[model samples]
Target: MAIKTKNISPDGKRQMTMQQFTAWLGRFDADKDGKISRQELADAVRGAGGRFAWWKCRQGLRSADSDGSGYIDANEIGNLVEFAQKHLGVKIVGF
Candidate 1:
């Protein structure tokens, strides 16, 4: 995630619409290539102060990149919902 637009709940989980969640993820597209690369994802998580960002990104990329393209694309963003909610503390409330 981009470490921006944090909407925390009382229980400490971040709440956001799917739009906000995807936007946050999109903020890390450093090359403006319309897809999130492994390096970009790792950098973003590390920038967010997440522990073991490399490892986490590895897993996230593995899980989210359903097509094995080694990047998260627009069509595959929803595949990241589960990983984001678990590791990124995001709750995508709705589309």
Candidate 2:
């Protein structure tokens, strides 16, 4: 199935400025955890009008989890953003 996404531009692209991404991470990174869990990602994806696929989400996490922590931390958020923009066609605005 195709990945779904909101917060996209009318140009048919997912747009996420660094500031926007950081703010979004903070909201879901509840429990004061430094990392984002798969469930959190799934919730966020769903919230963003995207379909949640466990394997796909895991793949995304793995792609960005540079430290192999199974979670996306601040240090790895850039990687996550890159992955989203690259494979998912998300445009990192204000880059």
Candidate 3:
């Protein structure tokens, strides 16, 4: 089925903007290495009050890390947010 952005959040409370996604990505860069690892992504999501399985989070990071560097940057995070918004139907707003 075709996915739509509007289908991301049903309550319209978790819609996250590009800026917010970028900010979250920055915060997730725990080591400040300009990239976020699988663990870092999980920690970042958890820290933001979002619950996700560690393995799942890791898998997501791995899938989104297009450069094969084992890390995800702002662009990757943005894509991830868009994917989550489309699939999870959670309006991920600014934290």
Candidate 4:
């Protein structure tokens, strides 16, 4: 089951569109495996000017890896998206 993420803005409107999330995934799915690995996520975070903490990455994987796959797949993508938004506080535009 996909975890639900509340993307509503202050006015309770959708803040991010699906296309934006898909584009975000494409930025980190370097192998095109439909999943974001720890290294890929770390690289993406670092590339975004965020501190790359190995421990935090592991924690993130644990938080987002709903299926115990050690990677963030489509089902858990919401968690990763929320993590980046909360932690990095950057508007991730297309690459």
Q: How many clashes in each candidate? A: 0, 0, 6, 0
Those runs of model 4 whose alpha carbons end farther than 4 Å from true positions after fitting are 1-18, 91-95
Q: Is candidate 1 or candidate 2 better by TM-score?
A: 1
**Per-residue error at 95 for model 1, in Å?**
5.0
- Model 2 ranges with Cα > 4 A deviation: 1-10, 86-89
* Number of the top-ranking candidate, with TM-score as the measure: 1
What are the TM-scores, per candidate, against the unseen true structure?
0.87, 0.74, 0.65, 0.67
lDDT of 1 by residue, 40-81 (tens): 888767766677888989999999999999999999999888
Per-candidate Cα lDDT values, in order, are 0.82, 0.70, 0.61, 0.64
Q: Which ten residues in a row have the lowest lDDT in candidate 1?
A: 1-10
Candidate 3, residue 34: the lDDT equals 84
Full candidate order by TM-score, most accurate first? 1, 2, 4, 3
Task: Looking at model 2, report the run of 10 residues with the lowest lDDT sum.
Answer: 44-53
Tens-digit lDDT track of model 4 for 48-84: 5566557657767877898998888887876676676
Model 2 RMSD vs true structure: 4.2
Q: For candidate 2, lDDT tens digit of each residue in 7-33?
A: 768878867778776676567666668
Clashing pairs in 1: none
Clash pairs, candidate 2, are: none
